[model samples]
Target chain A: MILEQTPDKSRKISWSYILLGISIVTIILFTLAPILWQVLTSVKTNEDISAIPNVYLPHKITLQHYLELFERRPFWLYIFNSALVSIVSTILCLLLGSPAAYALARMKLRGETIILVLIAVVTLFPYALLFLGVLEIIKNLGLGNNYLALIIPYTAINMPLTILVMRSFFRQLPQDLEDAAKIDGYKTISMLTAIILPMTLPALVTTGILTFIFAWNEYIFALTFITEETMKTVPVATAQLGGASLFDIPYGAIAAATILGTIPLVILVLIFQRRIVQGLTAGAVKG
Target chain B: MNNQRTGWILLFPALLLLFLIFLYPITRAFGLSLFTENLGTQLQPVFSGLANYQRMLGDGRFWQSMSNTAIFTIVSVALELVLGLSIALVLNQSFFGRGIVRTIAIIPWALPTSIMGLAWAWIFNDRFGVANDILQRLGLIETGINWLGEPGLAMVAIIIADVWKTTPFISIILLAGLQSISRDLYEAHKIDGAKPWQSFSQITLPLLMPQIMISLLFRFAQAFGIFDLVQVMTGGGPAGSTETVSIYIYSTVMRYLDFGYGAALVVATFMILITTVALVAWLFNRTKWA
Candidate 1:
């Protein structure tokens, strides 16, 4: 009976192992196929792109689509605008959010739970819903077509996530460290910059990357606020890539533009996968 | 008292910005909804109490968009939860090159939704699309399906794009929950002669409930307000069939220049979202108690 059971168990284990292997492959293919197809389409010539039988792979890869994309539109301007807005907003969000998070996490503040709950709710708000009012504000303040138009809102929009994630990280730290700093005659600002901030650098970087991504990818505000071609961000520019008529849709150039727009984010995700996951889950799970 | 002062000082800047951006807009939307300001009214602000809301009561387009938003949210969130859980389960296991697989899995979520939506549009194109080509090769269908041209299929296409893009987010959250569960529970369950399915149902599901609820609520809210994907892919087209509430409001405000009616739509959508979130939270808490 033992011998029979041993074989049966081994067979079952191998069967499940095989199943797991298949599932992993399927998951990878499902996630990566559309992206890989876009890459292929970008490199393919117009002839191959619109071929009757469909060209799975390019016959001869060409840089013409990429060239055409740059020549036809101000693609470089979009990239520059995206990077500037994302970086500035991320820096601003961190500057404002860190102290608030520290206060909520470490300081004996009144109504801390209410404040935190408010932050969480705000974090879940769909920003598109705020576009009409935000646009009005932008127009009235004459911030339209200016970098601050995107920067200010992006900074404010990202603050909740930044504060929530940082607060969670701060809560996990030992109270002894802050007490030690206090005994050393440190003020609140100095104590934060000198000790707590240095220790929670990873959390800062996590929140910073997440903020940068959000700012870079935001669409409605970018579209409504920046009408100038030179001020458009990657998402808005990419969405507006095709021709006026359906028949003249620039598939190849659009594909190239999509690839160009996504490369920066892809690199960021690959490098900071662990931190990104940590930041995203830190708020939701802990709360 | 000094420490409390310092704490409030530190908190003041962020709180002020949050209030200005979030609470102010919502309140202003409600205020703006009670006026008549659009192209037809010569873009001049006029006081008209409850007129826009009354119009919404008789508006078929608004109702259709609401139902569409509901379908998109329900179907996409449900799909993401199932797919995400499966991926999380697989990722939770130790395997060779697990890190690479995990990174690859989340690439979709990391990319901009608008750009990916465009890619999906091409993929679902009638003539040169990879989707049709593959189906034809596999003998699944003889003719190319006009994915974005048909009303029902347009919704399906957008949902597919949305599911692909967001499943990674849900999976990552679930994977975190899976990691927090103790291995001892599974081992103890096995010792009690529990099957793999039994252990998973009894141990994994119950333990992962909080994360599940959080992801569901987050995904539901995001999916309901979906704009970029639908805007880029179909532009809520093939005859307004795929238009979400966000898309409807966007057109009302931007295209039609109807600020008053748009504000009304915004306020109504916000109320619906808040109520649903509260209801879901209450239901989850009840389940937890039971």
Candidate 2:
């Protein structure tokens, strides 16, 4: 009777495991199906793409759509523009944000709470709400169509998260390390570069990745600020692909563009998934 | 004294930029809203105190977009919270390849919204969209549906896309919250002969409240100002049914070149956001006590 009962219980546990497996598969499919569809669509010929009843699988895979994207539009230019803006803005955000975060975390400064609260509020302000004013500033500064137009705003927008994340990391560091560096006659700048920064390298990388992803994916400002086709970022350029022609929709080329644009981000997510999750949770939960 | 000075010096640059980008714009928007500046005025500022505000009172488009925004935020956020919490709970349990699953889960959140919006638009395309194909295969519909061409359907499509992209973010935050929870509580509850559901309710929900509230508020502000998705998907669409406040404001200032009214709209939207956030925060606080 005992042996029979144990086998029955083990079978029940296996059944539950099966249920869990099924659920996991469903979640993965739901998360990936759209992206996978795009991948399939990207390689399909234009005829196959517009086929009646829809072509679930292409008869012949072709690179024609990708070639067409480059031929018909400044696709390479868009990639270059996006990369330049994202990298520069990310670096700027880190440079400016790290020091601020350090000061707030380490130094016993007056009005620290007020500054933090201000940052928290600013973090909540949608960039859409600030566009009109920012546009005005860009125009006044003659920064339109220039990379500065994108870089400056991206850095500023990402600053709040950068500071908040880095500040939390800084707070977690041992105070004795800083005190020891001070005793060794290290100045603030020297201590930061020599001791403090190296200790928070992981934090910097996490914040940098978050900032880079935001700068890369940003749309509204990219659309409004950079009207020059050569200067248009990936998101804006890819969006404009639809309306580039009146008659033909270029769905195949658009698919190719979408895949190309998302490849870098997908790679980032795959490689630094842990750090990205950490940065996001740290910024939101801790802040 | 020296340390305080160093702190101020270090903090000043970031604070200055934040002020210039955030605070100044908000204040300037308020001032600009009180003036009439548009093509009708040759893009020149004419003092028109409260005129834009008055116009907003009778503006049907503004109200429609506002209502649409409300629907999008409330519906998408509610769906995300439910879906996100479920995903978090599933992830919290020990499973094989959990790390890879979590990584794959967040890819949607990491991709550019505009790019994904375009992908979603194509997915819902009238002629060759996979959405129609899948639904037909499942025998859910007899014929092709023009998902983005119809008003109500367009909103549904946009909401679906938004939820897909953002649910992962909420899940990740909740997963962190779940990880921080001590396992001893669950074990003790189980020893008491408590059902799994009961333990989850008693041990998980209350502890995870803060993360839930944070994601809710964050997603609220984001969905309220949603621009990229709607703009790319339907361009506010078949009859402006999917036009969010951000899209409306963009077209107002950028397309119509109506800076004054645009600024007014900005200020009004900001107030609504602030009030709702405060109300939600207060409600959450009350619940915590209760």
Candidate 3:
């Protein structure tokens, strides 16, 4: 016998299997449809896209539109700006977020709850509602129409989650490790840099990836802050590019830009996906 | 205790950033809310006491936007949670090609909101859209639906778009929750001859409560603060049927240049969010503490 379970066990497995199968199929279709559509349309000409009977597959494939995005728009500049902003923002968020998270996690402060509440408050509200005031402050500080405005606010908004994540990761770590470092004569800063950080690589990577994605995909802040064309991030540039006019909305160019912009992130997600998923789902499943 | 100093020192940069960028703006916005004039004016915000609150109380648009927000948050968050949990439970099991499916599932969640908004807008287009094509092909409807053009259906369309984009997010989180549960618990349950539904109710749901709370909080926050999707999809149309509080505030600050009133609106949004977070945190604490 193949270790057949009792009727009840078999029935449970069957029901779960059925439900799982249905969900898998639903999720696969839902996730793939838009992506497939984006890829398919990227290769098709405008005429092919608007045809009465839609061409799901192109009879003739051409990379002309993707090629032309660079020819027409300052596509590469947007990519550079995005890269600079994302890299700088991610580094800053980690640098800033980790310490705050560590403090909130480890310290017994007088009003830690208040600080947590403060972080929560900032995260919950939309930046668009608060943009004008932020713009005012940015201008006053001589950071107007520059990348600093976006980077500062992006880091600020991301602080709470990053802090919470890093704090939780620090908290979950066995204290003995830190104690061991200390007993071995490692100073606090040295201990953190050498032992604690090295051990907390997974959490660090997770927070970094998530933060980069947020900064990379952020639109409203970049739109409101960086009005100068040269200062615009990828999403802002792509939106502006897409919204020029419905007639001139180069679907192929937009798709190409989207692909180019997101390809690195896609690869990053693929690489660290398990950790990212674990970190994200941490509060959801177990809490 | 020396370590505490290092912790504080380490935290100083973030604290400074928060104080300047987060605290100052919020405080200034709150202070501006108290004034009757724009912050841009030479005259600083003149103290108007509770007049801003008084004005907001009677403002029909404010109430209307709040109602719309309530509807949007409640309906969409609920649907996303249930669907997400169901899908998460399924995906949590051992299955062939599970890794590929899981990776692909995050595509919707990983998508830029603006792009998703644009894609969804095209999907819901009255004519030459994929959604209607599929629906018609399935014989679900005799005529094509004007998804974005109609009033009631516009909200539905926006919600559908939100659900499509965010349900995967909720699943990713909940699936994490499910993955954390020990398989031995299920083995024990099976040994006890518990049915699948029984195991789910007794084991999975209870174990997944924290994840559910987190998912609910994040989903509610996003939906309540939703702006870009509405901006791109309908531009708070057709006829302001989908005008959210964020949209209203954006117009006040950007379009009308009513910084005082816009600041007041921001204050109100902040209060609502704080209340929601506090309430949820309190509930979670109570459950855990008890």
Candidate 4:
């Protein structure tokens, strides 16, 4: 060692412990407050929500807003449209992405880094860039306010990252398994199904979850493509909560819808926290 | 031979889809930028050879949007980086309930931005909003402040909402960076008479630079084109103060039916982003951080 004098190392450790405790409390409270406020707002009566000096808690927790959300707007359609588009896009992304990824992984394509960078760059584009051309195509095809309008673009927008994530996973798999499967008389397609598919469950789940969340929360395309009241996705519908008629901006109902719209994602994040955490850090998915 | 064929076959469908949806549209937008047709006068396209871009250089709204985009990007991403690194460092310590803490952190990032923007809008709402209420109660102000009804405050509100929504993402990325740095380095540094702060600056910072740069790039791009938050929270607002380039272009094309000009704006924004990314990448490579 070069030297030994460091100021009060033991005391520093104790001080660090104190700092850690304070940080934990602060982080928890800071992260939880806005959400908790919204949740409280969800349960509050409308009058309580709008009350001067703001109601900190629900005077009476009610499901009326939840029910009224469905009654007053086409909230159910939003959920259905969101689910259908996200699920289909995620599946399509996987099916189309995985095979290409497998090829990149196994065949060891030239310009692999270039391809990955290109994909990354694609994902980085202003999502609004996809709006105009896609909108024109949708209108030209007369897919007016239709699910296909959202699906085509969502699937396309999500594909690059999906491929990158899947490619990384596929590349990490051992090659001897594929060799063994080939020796056992399995063709490339069969080997992919029988050997590779089962091995990539974690990657598939992460990609699917991330992709679904992206599509599910996608706002711009949904807002632009689907203008009809009946065709709105969850985000569009949620934004339109107060826009139904200018006179009727239901605060509690908006909160209830937000909470409702967010529940599935919250649950997904809880279940797949580890995979999501890993995928995010690897730069495999878009921010 | 068979394997190569299979590989190409597998890639064909995805490449075709990408060509149709992503690449093709971008090319169309680029080509559309050189036109003279006002979408309001006629839907027909006429090639005018860079006229739209020429006009963009002189447009005040274009400059406003460019700066607005820059301010939003610089301020929000800078805050996210600092806050993210702090939280990441905190989380890196072995602590009680770390898993729960991490999950709690992910919740905001996981939720939809527009919905959360709505919540924030309510929070900042002047009449019955929590922000004014809390400020009044604490004697921070004597009267209600119209948080989003003013230009500067509106931008600040957007930035605040953006930082709250996105800091977790940067924190998570940097956390992964912090975790990957070997504990043994710090241990060795301790023996060498290096204080904790010294070890952090000399070791953790340089080592974390790659992740930090990458995360910054990602956050920069995202914030540069932010639409949902501003659209929902302030809608480019109190007097076009928060009008990001994305918001501006969205209205120019969608609301005002200026497709040619809008296309020019998109292409211009793309060039700016590309140049910024290139410069950053060059810097990183020069510094060997990439």
Candidate 5:
């Protein structure tokens, strides 16, 4: 209504609407097209993808590329390794990170802020940098070519963020809840297990989901540490699509592998969509 | 009746695991940095002082990686922030299909980096890639450019891949921030005869600073430490143009069997990341308390 008095307001309104429209269209196309292209190419025969000025949609959909995917590599083994590592690491991180987070949140330590900051700092230390030291420790312990090597580091790197998230959620709980639980004669661990843990389910699920995804997608450490074919995780095996010796970089196969790799992650996101969004935003904004 | 002590006691298991598995290796990395070990013998870790740091300082390759990392982080993060904020604002509106669009938009971010690299690598293929195909069909180019093969274009390609996978991440965070802002504030601004731009600049942006900072922190850290995508896409190849610090460290320790030197590089990287993140945390805390 304020703009009604100003003639230029209509011009600006139209311009802004146009801008927003263009922006939306551009982002949708830029993001979705490449992904859709991957899917389309995956279903296309070799000749279709190789043809000049590729068709937007394949004339006939085929599962030949996907079939070739299984034929060319031990994808099942790689997926099994990925699942094993992701699940184990998620469990480990939650087990460690949750308690540490609770302690930091409730322990009344003199330098809780410093401890939290320390955890935050650790999140920035990527596995790439730490892989060297981790390798030596893993080798020294004779745990190479094992899932423990990947799971341990994944848990370690993810601990800080998990702790930060858990700590924040724990901080918001009323102290009286714990005091009342104690009044009811619940033991310390029992109180945590029965009362606090249930209250903090959302935080736990958030941390678990993020941890699982990170571990599931982890690559460099797995690549460097596990050379055995059976030990290779999804990311490592999928990355081999781009390796030098591969046959002309098999576009269809790579697309199929990419789709396969995205499936579990997409499923995780869909199932935990609400919790993930809630936890991610709340953790960041409040912290 | 002392619940706090018991809480700390309960924390011991987790703390011990962290100290043994996480803390030890980091400090060990620092210690390893001081040593030099030759591969041919049962070499003792002899102290080499700051020679490794000095070597990295003067190494052209390290500097190149550093520059590449800096460019990739700063530029892509800037774009992501801008795009993410706009998208978040749009999604914050009462529009149809918002949920569907938001969910679908997040697919790129949810997908793994290595997988994304594989997907984009196919898209960038000089021969059969969709990118070149689209460009040629649209008459944008006469011939397909070898996007990932060239030195200059390689960085751009990597940035494209990174942005595709991360803009949604930034948007999701910003959207969270956007949701926290009350409708009353915008209503108040409207009463004051504020334009949309004015409202955004004066109200939305200031309130969103914390979220923006966190987004920057997460994105910058991820970008700086990028390894899987570059490794999968480029492998620091075509004369090591796309090699990141992670790849460099990987090659040094695993490929060349120089554990001590590799450890030194890692320690250096850890120190830098910790220092930078600490500084940001401090700044945020100061602003918050002040």
Candidate 6:
């Protein structure tokens, strides 16, 4: 609206609209297709799934796969385990990461940069070897197949980014509130609890969701540590899904399970996408 | 000085956990890599220095996995970069339904990779899979191709799956970069009679280099250590052809229970990744934009 409608500007027929249309179509097809296909398959009968000519649409929709999924397998347990582990570990990550982040943000020290780099580098550490080491130590500590097995490592591994995001979030807060609280003889912890935390609810939620998603999605540790069937998380249990022989692909249950497993995260993403983006970019851009 | 002391005290818990969970385990892995310890036997102190390393060097499967890792990382990251940049460019535009589109874009990224890998495996299934059905519908192929059956096609399938899941991550990072660019530069370029492509190349790419490199480094390290997708889709099969270093090391440690050799493999993998990251970081630092 601000632009002067020069002859050239008026002559240009806004090809960007056309481009936008094409991009939207391509994005829908590429990005949404697989997920949509999974959803469709989730509702299809097994016969419909492997029909001679791919049954683009299900003739008869059924909740049988969903029923069978829960009946045949303890997927409820997997969901419960995933929820408990992710929730606890995400909390633990925030508790540990917040203090360090606050310290780094507030303190001006010679080795501050070095410490930040150290934290950042840990996130870059390859997990294959790291998981092997962690598993050994867990076994040595007599913690194999225990919930602590996954929780401790998940909390530890997610620390770097959590700290970085929290640090960036903390740095932006006004010093006046803390100074005012100090004048009233409010201690640091109480001040943080009453004022800073209550004020930074968005940041806390952002950090919490980011860590929650990471812990939920983690596979290798959960797979390796919890050899017991019931202890597996959704991701691992879904991967090693029973009833799918090499010959007969359990497309029905697999589809149902995939949809069921992913729907919660997708809902969270739909809600808090902006916050997640902030957390993701905060570390990369600042570093 | 007072603040520093207080800060350190505040930071103590995180530091302690890092030492316990991350640093200590890393150092212990390195130490364990030095000795030959078979997991079947008792925990004995028979130190066989460099033996595990020697075995790793001679192992064909190790080299195969190393190469497989290199191929997967390089190819997948390359495809993701191109697609991601395009997506970011489009998403950056002001248009109708952009909010919905942006949310849709992040969904693939939010979905767990391992589960998505499973989804992809099913989608690319030999007889009744959608990939084959779609291709055949388009007249691209005469018959259903067993996408995960052959080695090369399996690699392609996995890479495609990886790209689908991860491109959004690259796009989001680059979109953040794209949004931060000044409008004045584009307007100036427009006044100068520069083409859109010219503006993109001259104005945008240069400014977006830092984000580009960071995403590259981040994704490179991630793709290098890819496990779940490879594990789920192929199980590194059609004869261990798609097996990555992570899968190899994982199988050695978990399935084979070869602690010593797996440790050596771990150390080797660590060295490669660390060196590559350092090199990329050095390149990043050398670049004027960085």
The number of the candidate with the highest DockQ is 2
lDDT-wise, the better of 3 and 5 is 5
DockQ per candidate, 2 decimals: 0.84, 0.87, 0.53, 0.66, 0.60, 0.71
User: Which of candidates 2 and 4 reaches a greater lDDT?
Assistant: 2
- Give the TM-score comparing model 2 with the true structure, all chains together: 0.98
Q: Which residue pairs show backbone clashes in model 5?
A: none
Per-model TM-score of chain A alone?
0.97, 0.96, 0.87, 0.90, 0.90, 0.93
After superposition on all C-alphas, the RMSD of every candidate to the true structure, in Å, is 1.1, 1.4, 3.3, 2.7, 2.7, 2.7
Q: What is the interface RMSD of each candidate, in Å?
A: 0.9, 0.7, 2.2, 1.5, 2.0, 1.3
Query: Against the true structure, what is model 5's DockQ?
Result: 0.60
lDDT of 5 at B281: 73
**Candidate 3 lDDT over residue span B1-290, tens digit each:** 67667767877888887777667777888888987765455445667877888999999988888888888889999999988887787787789998988887776777678766776766777765677878888889877789988989989988988888899888898787787889999999999999878999999999988778877887888898898788878878887788889888888777777778888998898888879888988989998889
Task: Tell me the TM-score for chain B of model 6.
Answer: 0.96
The segments of candidate 2 whose C-alpha lies over 4 angstroms from its true place after superposition are A1-8, A243-245
- Model 5: residues with Cα > 4 Å off, grouped in runs: A1-22, A242-247, B1-4, B40-44, B282-290
Question: CA lDDT of B197 in candidate 4?
Answer: 91
lDDT tens digits, residues B24-121, model 5? 77898888887786484355677888877787888898777777777777889998999889888877875566677677767777788988887887
Which whole-number lDDT from 0 to 100 does residue A93 have in model 4? 88
Model 2 docking grade: high
Question: After best superposition, candidate 2 residue A47: deviation in angstroms?
Answer: 1.0
Candidates 1 and 4: which is better by DockQ?
1
Model 6 chain A: ten consecutive residues of lowest lDDT: A1-10
Where does model 3 exceed 4 Å of error? A1-19, A104-121, A242-248, A282-287, B1-3, B38-47, B141-143, B283-290
Ranking by lDDT: 2, 1, 6, 4, 5, 3
- Candidate 6 stretches with Cα past 4 Å from truth are A1-14, B39-45
TM-score of chain B of 3: 0.92
Error of 5 at B164 (Å): 0.9
Candidate 4 chain A worst ten-residue window by lDDT: A1-10
Mark the regions of model 1 whose C-alpha exceeds 4 Å error after superposition. none
TM-score per model over all chains: 0.98, 0.98, 0.90, 0.95, 0.92, 0.95
| lDDT tens digits by residue: candidate 5, A110-201 | 56677666666666667677666677788898989988888887787677767878888988899999899889999767888899988887
